[model samples]
Target: MGHVFRTEQQALALDSLSRFLKAEVEPLYWHDYRDTFVPKEKLLPVTQQLAEFGLVSGVVSEEYGGLGADWLTNAMLFEEVAFTSCDLALLVLINSFGAYMLEKLASEALLERYLPGLVNGSRFVSIAISEPDVGSNVVEIKARARSTGENYVLSGEKTWISNGAYSDVLICTCRTSDEPRGGLTHFLLDRSEHPYEVQNIKKVALNSQSTAQVFLPEIVVPAHNMLGEKGEGLRNTLALFERSRVFVALCAVGIARRALHEAVHYAQERVQRGKKIAGHQLISAMLAEMATQVDAARLLCYRAAQMIEADLSAEMEAAMAKYFACEAAVKVTRQAVQIHGGNGVTTDFMVEKLAREALILPIPEGTSQIQQLIIGRALTGVNAL
Candidate 1:
């Protein structure tokens, strides 16, 4: 039963999610209103609908009002959403990540206060870690949190924060002490009551998602809002990375698959030299390579998901999956553009959007270079970064 259960249940769940995406999301892909930065009104209805299906909190524990599905199931759901819109997928993904951390590390009182609204999609959350001077270097952040008797005063700036403008709560990392790696701490900030401000940033891609520069000026968080134990934020953040990398890899897989699918469809329909472009060996070779890489990325992503579900040490595996999937997605998107020729560069052709979105995958979650360093350190027992 375990063998059959694994095979059939997983397939059935994926099939259902794929159908949902086709019915609800695919039709909206070409809508004139779809943008990288999803507006609050537009995002609220969609998120509410997804909440009815328990998607927003699928990874959280069932006791906390989530589906409590395994990591592979969540990965499949992420892939399906990406096939529809990467921006929407991100909107949901960031919320899920914040909720997962709160469930795992926050005090029970904190969980009771936040998890319900988060799971029901009534509230949005985002992580604020990247700073103007520190994009991927968590240890070097200058954001400081000073204890002031009854509360902590947080002062600093965070740039490139996803969902920054719209999020109701922010799980932010700040330096609390001067213990180098151990000095960092995580705080749950209620943006509504805080003196923080968000300024949207324009970008070359991912224009539909809200990426912003966040400013905090003596924002006071209750002492109870500290996640985990004081001085343990760095360690907790590292643990969160294991799960975050898997989701990022899944996003890469979805983006790559969609790009390849569009390119193949174009090749089969467009006639060049009195035959379909797909019939030409050059085009066929490109499509073939793209298909192979997409499959490889999917397998690696699933393997990493499985490792996370099995309670194994997946740091190296997660890094490898994210690195390979993101790089492969970039390659696939570039080839997709080549296959479509001039049409690929225009907004009318979806491949252009895919290409733009693919460019950002390597830089988010963790950069491909950072992934390489993680894997290097894992294999060589030497801290290369």
Candidate 2:
């Protein structure tokens, strides 16, 4: 029912995307992505195809190559794509993520230099914000950049960066001073400069996508590379974060829906005690709960997205959406696994992969605990952490 509030154009766009993903993309994701990343050779062709169709920034002005669509349209597209492949969904979103920020904060010359390639899928982008010691605490980031008249020298490390290993341009956060607030600056760095090292990490889940640690030691970027006003990186990033968490919530909603659908399909056919398992009261109750939670999560994500489109403050709304949707996904996927019995853990069933992917949804953008802290502060006007 995500289409409940959508316009006719929005409905048509989402419908078109859904048919394309299911017909052309889902098989590749389910098959090629079983053991490893959908190979770059296999993934890029499809990604470039979608970029030509306007998956970049649907909310931006048409002059910037965006469709002048709404945020809800973009979120709907991503959510539907996530139902097919969370890995591809992530790449789709992150492709334009750093580029959109550049569009917002980069100098006109810089944007002219990079935005087209970024928007059209020729250039790869990554956002470097978290450090080994710092996740949600932006004020404690240890990466440092110092102005050197012509350029700024950067030194620090970032971990858990998606696309870090392959980024052409990286938007990196650095400490410009020792102050807890207003000391941070974001620098747009060219990774080909050889100022940093990236090592792709191996993880138990989401292995079909890239995750890496980035090390920057004395890397220098042009003075104009600073994004947004100096000393305002945290504020800018927080603004981005509020919206990003909602997209992450969409990922959860997608996974939850897919998992719920799979469970229902399985229950209808699997027989136990001379009857289909779906006919059993306890099994039916689990299915009922899963369906209810997935829709609820979807509603929460759409509510947060609508607030973002309205240009309203959504810090608390985003936190609520992220926390509820991700937890809902985890619960739904767990039930799916239980319903599938031993088949759930095997590679033979897609539910196994869905379960692993679901486990990852609550960690990024902000941990559920961090979201709770944000919501708590909003409600009580006191910092709990």
Candidate 3:
């Protein structure tokens, strides 16, 4: 059981959050809006509410108006959120990580300007890394940032950026030099000060969140806006990924858990051949498998979270969690649909949306394939990519 890993405080926090989400957030996501983006205006109210429990200002220390909850606690919170609404969970995730980045790397002035709003959820933030030609390969990033005296003139495009359309601040990865390893740099761009363009990309699922292409054509960012040391973006980003991949895995676990619940509930109620489908051997077997997979995925995610909390290197464990959990989500959700029979493919059922949402989990954070390579590289001590 997940309770095996969580502390009493963490369990209590998750319980409170579970009730809050059910009463306050679930209606907005499931009853009012489905298969469409909740406008930023509506979403902000929920995010602000989440900040009360430290979901928004994640990893930022309490001195900065953040809860400074441990990563394991945060993982539990987000997993609960994803169970209620994966789309909303993602919006919270990007803000949380953005706040963490600012707390960790931003200059005092940069922190003063952005951290408050990000902590309170009034401002949204995004990390821009993937280019049209680059995914999972940070060294090959093509977005260019040229020094111009006191400022850096940035010009490039970033695709598949979550929160791109709504970001108040963007931690963008840019190629500042020609060298492969040290070329990459991180710049903190305020949307109001350094304007850029965004075009929202439509997708198969998670439509309630923004996934967009960000275009920066010679946007001038002050040198002070640079995050961390220059030429250290790749190293910094990789460090973040070691933990982030675990959170992403938890999201997949949440989706699978929901699908499993839906299938079990449906089987108990639906009758086939003069008996409840839950009584049928094949349906029962599917239910058993779904429960096992969901718990297994949850264990892996919690293990990775524990490692991160202990400040251990979880590069290999994180990759394993992400790869296993995301694939489990796809499999479990498909099985949920099959258990629902004809109704599963229809919009009237939540399983349909769960299935669509599950499909997107393996793509972001890192593709399932990329996660496998990371795991393989860890095992063999050889770089496959």
TM-score of each: 0.95, 0.96, 0.98
lDDT of each: 0.85, 0.84, 0.89
- Across 286-369, the per-residue lDDT of candidate 3 in tens digits comes to 989999899989988888988998988999999999999999999999999999999999988889999999888898888988
Candidate 1 off by > 4 Å: 1-6
lDDT per residue, candidate 2, 1-385, as tens digits? 2336778887888888888888778888887666476666776667766675557656445787766667777888889888988877777677667766887898998788877777776777788899999997879999999889989999989999887765788889899889888998889887777457888888767777778899997897888888998899899898889888898899898899999889999999999999999999999999999998988888888888889889999999999999999999999999999999999888888888888889998899999999999999999999996
User: After best superposition, candidate 2 residue 236: deviation in angstroms?
Assistant: 0.6
| Candidate 2, poorest ten consecutive residues by summed lDDT | 52-61
Which sections of candidate 3 miss by over 4 Å? 1-5
Instruction: Name the best candidate (by lDDT).
Output: 3
Backbone clashes, each candidate = 7, 0, 0
Instruction: Report lDDT (Cα) of residue 353, candidate 1.
Output: 82
Clashing pairs for predicted structure model 1, backbone only: 35-208, 36-207, 36-208, 36-209, 37-207, 37-208, 37-209
